[model samples]
Target: MTALHCDGSLTADRASYGGIIRDDNSVLGMELLAILRGVTLCIQKDLLRVSIRSYSKLAVDILNGIVSCPWSLQALKVRITSLMEQLQRKEIRHVWRELNQPADFVAAIDTGDGESFFYPPDFPLDLVELIKNDSDRKTYFRTPSH
Candidate 1:
């Protein structure tokens, strides 16, 4: 499944953990990504002390949608809130589609004889691609050796 890290800016005291709920309309793969991300972190830190395995491409795409979910409408917010309260947690993990392109490619772009894009009733291809491309290009330019 797709796993990612996110960072947010703060002005005053501290930043709220930024977490997104996957779009429920999509497949459960996105949810799996969130779970996998947590599992991955725990394994890396040797905290939970458990074995972890990567998820399939389908799972990753689903996770991408999940990562884009707005927590305000997600039911998982309650559990997150409770856990944070008990742990004094501040940082939130999130998986965004752009950052998890491998899955996106497998599910859409890399699919054999398949379409690589979608156009919602109001969404424009150029605009969306333009924004994503612009950000990536910016990053490439800002690299230390650039």
Candidate 2:
């Protein structure tokens, strides 16, 4: 089984989405983009069984058909559904941000308007550390907002 964590980040003037840095300013859009990218990657690599984790409940709900996809996202919804049908087994789940730190870190990286695909050997040190901690099942505490 292939396990993937997906996330998206948005700021007032910029966005890092789906391993690609772009001008897309919608958070939910970015979240869906991440899932799409992850799912596509899995299919391309012939990973037939997959578990996808995302911190965006809305994105998870949309993918799971528990909620209606927004009009603006209909195309993305269709594409994701089409890709998911190719998988032999798949699960898309909503998780808390703390539990998805590695993906969040990747989503927050500035790739200078380009996409990044990190093979294990090419992962940034910080992301590598995060992945190690995740594999070790280390707990992360969420800090309260000011």
Candidate 3:
């Protein structure tokens, strides 16, 4: 369909930089939590429709920016404490930076493009695919609620 074609062309894979990488573990973790929530929202929103095509990638880029930081653990503790007090949010993960990079990269860039030219990398795949595949089988948000 004309609309589907247009939407497909402007998918989440077109996002830009994830954000200023912060090495703080606490802040990075909290940021990651926010990002995960945002990503879930995107998946549920059925963005691959003509309705949001024009601003789709920007949405994704912003989400990636929130979740993919490289802040330090000490800085993270202070940052997370301040963020929690300010936003009333909590930090969830305590994982290493290397473990999170793939998710970060996929969200910020299309995996199909290949990395040499920053087109897309073969080693890294889209995290959205994982989310879509793992989603509830009978509950696509795009479908009319029963």
Candidate 3 wrong stretches, greater than 4 Å: 1-72, 89-127, 137-146
Clash numbers, per candidate: 6, 0, 13
lDDT of 1 by residue, 32-139 (tens): 544444544454565643322223343433233443434443454334333334332233334344444433433444336733444444445645664567467534
**Among all windows of ten consecutive residues in candidate 3, which has the lowest summed lDDT?**
48-57
| TM-scores of the models, in the order given | 0.24, 0.78, 0.25
Q: Note the Cα lDDT for every prediction shown.
A: 0.43, 0.87, 0.38
Badly placed stretches (over 4 Å) of model 2 are 1-25, 142-146
* Error at 79, model 3, angstroms: 1.2
lDDT of 2 at 144: 86
lDDT winner among the candidates? 2
lDDT of 2 by residue, 1-146 (tens): 22344689899998886643443226789899989999999999999899989989988998899989888889998999999999999999999987899999988988888797778989999999999998999987778889
Candidate 3 yields a Cα-based lDDT of 0.38
Candidate 2 global CA lDDT score = 0.87
User: Which window of 10 residues has the lowest lDDT sum in candidate 1?
Assistant: 49-58
